[model samples]
Target chain A: MVPLSWYLVVAFMLVGLGAYGMIVKKNLIRILIGAEIMGNGVNLALVAFAVYGGAFSFTAQGLIILVISVAAAHTALALVLMLMYNRRYGTVDLSIVQKEEVA
Target chain B: MNWKVKMMQDLQPVLDLFEQFEFFLIAALVLALAYLALEHKDIVYAVFFFGFMASAVAGFFLLLDAPYIAGMQIAVYTGGISALIIFGVLLLPRAQDSSLETFATGRVRTMGLILSGVIMAISGGLALIFPWPETIPEGVPEQSQSLQGLAEWLWQDHGVYIQIIALIILTTLVGAVALLKMEKAEAMSSITGEFGVEAKPSPEPEAETEVVDTEETSEEAAN
Candidate 1:
């Protein structure tokens, strides 16, 4: 069997990559994508820990069901917000908010 | 007979190493696809890579012997969330100049890189340094391995969490529909005063064609 630490290493790396996406990307959609990635990374870590606990594995599986549904809801709502943002500004450039010309 | 016995002993270690190697490749693929998703310039392709990354995550779950979660990952992430993103893209206004607007400034990006790198290093380093058992401990209740056990654990103890999540999903569904149903004119009405002259498009020139956008939404809203 694969050791526990390896999964953790990968999971954290994923979180890091997702963080990069969320921070550097200008588009709202890309930011959302980054958030999704970060969530997945966390989920992987949780599942790993649960597997290690043995008895907790079942609870974790059930928990993942909750997590996945919540994530789906999260994405849908975020996209709706992005749509609103775009329609208001006529663009999704995101940097538009920084400009002093528009209050 | 001695040589044959030695070969059998050697094969066990190799087989174990092969299992570890297989998992390593999945981990590598997940990270690689994640990197691609982050770095890709085009938003659609970035979403595409993100979808693949999620699928790779599902495969990782399978590696951990959680087949049910893996299937759910594929269904929810690869199927549902990806479709939502694509639809969001479709609903987006087409930009006049699209090439250079996707990334932040170099300084901001560099700062992000440093912060996230520090975070990943701390977390992963902690996990690595912590002494964890090499295998699952013995005498674990056998119920953990079965679906019935998972259901019992979830519903019996954690029903509260499940209920809360369901409520959130319900709210989200309602909110998304409400947001989508709102007209563009209404959405921008508050900001209209600030950008009054710029709001309405003049058909005479190609000017502000970027803001003008598709006639479809306006027409649909009229209906």
Candidate 2:
């Protein structure tokens, strides 16, 4: 069996990448990408636990599906927000657009 | 050298292969695609690469023995979320001028880099320090047999919560349509000669000045 530590490490690395993306990227869509990365990280952790803990039953599967669906729903909302940002500001940059709004 | 020989002797080939190759391969691929999505200049392509990365991650989930989640990942992420992101990208105006310049500079980037460095350091430290459980616990219920039991529990114990989540998703779809519809109406109002009345008034002032100058010429003709 694959060790739980290995999966945990991969999840951590992915989460770190997501954090980096979220911090470094200024574009609204890019930030959404980072957020998706973070969500993937969480999903990885959940699946890892389910497998490692020997809890890979249907309830666990159902919960994982539920989480995935929720994430998809959230992504939809974020995309809508990105569209609104692009429309109102004519630019996707978080900093420039916010500056314009304040001014 | 001796320890390596003993370890190989004890471990199954499948586990060895997973540890040696597949895990790292998927991890590297996911991280690389995520980096590309964030660093790429074009927002449209970033979204596209993100879709690829999400699907790859779903493959990883399958390897981790979570088939249900793998299906959901592909279905909800690659199919639903990615499609929505692409639609949003298409709806944006094609003009790219000034957008790149707005994001490429300033203190925010510097701060973000610093924060990411700190987070990476912390996560790395945690991974190193935490000792993972070596084996699955004994006497735990077998996963395959528990499937029917889980189904019963889900329906009997958590059915209400599942229904609520379904309702929330439905509401979100409705809300997104309503929001987009309002924006379209607003855009139409702004463009269709209704909101540009101020722009026409400046030309009207110039026309009035011309009319005043032509008034004497018309009077001469009348006389």
Candidate 3:
């Protein structure tokens, strides 16, 4: 079996890339994708730790499943919000704020 | 030698592949896909890449021997969430330029890159330095091999979490319906006010849409 540390390194890289995308992306949907990537990194790390240590492996998997469901729920709500924003403002760009500009 | 034995011999090297190399390849594929997804200017392409990333993460779970999680990842993230993202993309209006405007440029890009790099270095170094326990206690059981134990765990010990998640899903369903409903109830109230009728507030968009469906209510409100 390979050492556990390598998995951690991979997860770290994923988180870094996700953070970069989140910081740089202007589109709301792209930003959400970045957030999803970061969540995946966290899930990978949790599973890796559980697999290596053996203890809490079941719990870890359960929690990961929960995280997936919660993320789905969040994505649904976020997409609806994005749709609402698009309908209201006619664009999905994050640079525009209605309170400051319209009111 | 028999044909089966001959085939097995031929596939021996492939079957005996080390986990390390497998890990490396999967990690590389996942990272590459992630980069592509993030860098893609087209929202639809990025959404598809996101699905691929989720599928790759499911592969990682399989490598970890968590087959249940791998299946769930494929079903939920790759299948369901990707479809939702695509629908959102379809609903979005076409940009005049066809190119997404990104704020991640110049000074901001430099700062983001530096910050992410430092974070990755620190986390990687810490992981290497930390002494993780060598093995898990008495190996995870064979019975827990699939999702049997997970199902039991959810019902017996973690039932509350299941209920809570169900509640969250319900809330999200209602909230989404409200947010995406064809005409805001607030806008409807303004129309009602213009017609000089006392506006009945409908907090739920489902109700508002239903009311709009009935011409009588609208006519009464207008009158």
Report residue A98 deviation for candidate 2 (angstroms).
3.4
For every prediction, compared with the true complex, DockQ reads 0.59, 0.47, 0.50
Report the C-alpha displacement of residue A95, candidate 2, in angstroms.
1.9
lDDT (10s digit) by residue, model 2, range A4-92: 77777777777877887787766666677788888888788878777767556565667777788788788887777776665676656
Please tell me which model should have the higher DockQ, number 1 or number 3. Answer: 1
Model 3 gets an lDDT of 0.80
Q: Model 3, residue B131: displacement in angstroms?
A: 1.6
Clashes of each: 0, 0, 1
Q: Which pairs, if any, clash in model 3?
A: A53-B136
lDDT of each: 0.80, 0.72, 0.80
Model 2 fnat value: 0.59
lDDT tens digits, residues B112-154, model 1? 9999999999998988897766455755433454566666777
Q: Which pairs, if any, clash in model 1?
A: none
As for candidate 2, its clashing pairs are none
Residue A96 CA error for candidate 1 (Å)?
A: 0.9
Candidate scoring better on TM-score of 1 and 2: 1
Residue A97 displacement (Å), model 2: 4.0
Which scores better on lDDT, 1 or 2? 1
Q: What is the Cα-based lDDT of residue B29 in candidate 1?
A: 90
